[model samples]
Target: MSAADPTRSHGPGGVHPIARLPEEWEAYFEANGERAFRGAQVFRWIHQRGELDPAKMSDLSKAWRVRLSEEGLAPPFELVEVFRSRDGTRKLLLELVDGGRVECVLIPMSKESDEDDESPATSGSSAEPPTDRRRKMTLCISTQLGCAMGCVFCASGQAGLVRGLGAAEIAAQVLEARRHLDDGEVLSNLVYMGMGEPLHHYDETARSIRLLSHGEGAGFGLRRITVSTVGLVPGIRRLGEDFGGKVGLALSLHAPSDDVRQKIIPMNSRFGVRDLVQSLREYPLPRRRRITIEYTLISGVNDQPAHARALANLLRPLSVKINLIPMNVIDASSLAAPSDEGVERFRDLLVQAGYSCFLRRRRGDDVAAACGQLALAERLVRPSASS
Candidate 1:
């Protein structure tokens, strides 16, 4: 099926059983003449064990299991493809109930390094003690099938917005992605940087977070999940207020000033740099955690040393670290990727200015690992979101 298919959502309009909380499920069981504890059992079976087939839930009674199966305890989406890169990155293409498709990526992180050493692919996970050595992977998931924030450099938004995924579809990505984990390699972090502007659909995005982080559910840590945005100020503030700023926030600040930002990030005209920085300052980011600033360096655009200085000056007041991403230049975009030497110079200036900065190494390039890259050809061939 095509990646984009307009369909009714299971959000405010409807609620999918996969998106239900334990209490909500408890009520559902009681309403259906079943025991209340069955709700928790069903939830554990789905979220904790990643078992969608009720018949496989060994603890549940035979009748209850049969009833649950009849009620359609099935996966919200099917895992259609798994493309693995040489560097251990896996991109999962998922087809939703209404024939809509999205992608999620699992990227293994570099082992812990010294403070002065270069860092790993931006693992959204927080820092642990250096003594701990474990293989960690971060899954980059999509909140929409296609994006609304048409950033100039992003492959995801190249095709424009299709539709925001429902909370069930959003939450299900993790449950499904977990099933593909390799032995001894842990799924430790999540970054919402795959195919959409997460904040554009704030309600469903927030609901998915709550659903994933609930102890009785997937129990994914809020701090480990980074929500990347293109500066939707109200949604950013609401995220801080709603989650008490526990959720990691990463801003796609590709340009230092409004003039440059407005030229590249179409949404920058709505939320200017000053206002976005002010919102970050107001955020209640936990003690030791810093807001991540994502800077995509495009040649002759935002990669000059002067631009770096301006970026440092603008973000100086806020507690933040910079992730320098060399632009993934595509044929469709007029922008060109910054030279390796130029990228290092930009990072040098940021480091000289006393900001913790790291170059975000591109993983899974062979597999078109970057967001929506795998779909780029297909999207171009069929621009229509028709299924």
Candidate 2:
């Protein structure tokens, strides 16, 4: 089976050629009458070195190189454009093979007073080097071309879901983002928090994680990856079971009550908050790892003190850290974030209720890189390209 064949015929053991793990590659090589060690070598060459051109793989013989070339290795998408925010955030737009476009953002963890002051100071003078002070970057990637979950506040879901991305299309976003990293910076964390709800594409997302965290691949620690979902109960349970809860899970629990949630996040009508909380309780989280509860504070909506109290009460049974995001305004919606004073008051109520809570500082708002603000403008300007 030649790689150019669009059928994507699996190797001897049903491994997709491009997404094969090391052991699968070994099985393929053994089946193809080649040494098993060549599999590991090929895996490293493609993932570790990011060398997809089989002709550039110098370690293999001429005949083997020709065979591997037939079993192609290429990225499923291409980077189209990048919008850099004044605050050092970069929003990347990628075009898939079928002409579908998705957006991803790269956010650098800040070291200014806002972030540093939050951490308690040490007693003695710090001996850490200046290079250690460089902040780690988190790349937010998309699981689908567009979102199916019609969250009233998110721009990605405004048009409805286009299609789910393949595992290679998902992992390629990381490889493309890494090329734009600045000096003294390292890509540390990854959030499935851009463009689409990750749980909507569970199988492809799971395979992408394995490809990203494999020792021969991107090598990211499982702890460094966070998958955000809009309370997809079955997907949440499956993720916990598959990864043994080692991967970070972030729940988009925007409202305290089912009535309020259903209005903002339509998915709540399918899986209520009660069911979501039950799913969280069953997730086998590792010790000291807390599930992130993302509550977007919208003006005159879910930002009231009573709502905060209810949220705190609702989460009392589970181990969680609350991140209160003042919603970013979108052109498609008239909804807006609560006032600074109101947001602070809401956060205070949660804190007084004995829950660890934080008012998340909005990042990259100037360039439309904040939460729920991606893909809408691009979709408007490039409507023809999207089709």
> What's the CA RMSD for each of the models?
4.9, 5.2
List TM-score per model, in order: 0.89, 0.88
Local error of candidate 2 at residue 193 (angstroms): 0.9
What overall lDDT goes with each candidate model? 0.79, 0.78
Name the lDDT value of residue 46 in candidate 1. 78
Q: Which candidate ranks first by lDDT, i.e. highest?
A: 1
lDDT of 1: 0.79
Candidate 1 lDDT over residue span 248-345, tens digit each: 99999999999999989999888999999999999999887888999999999889999999999999888888899998877568889899999999
Stretches off by above 4 angstroms in model 1 are: 1-14, 70-72, 111-133, 378-387
lDDT of 2 by residue, 259-368 (tens): 89988999998999999999999999998878999999999989888899899889999999888899988777889879999998998999899987877787787778
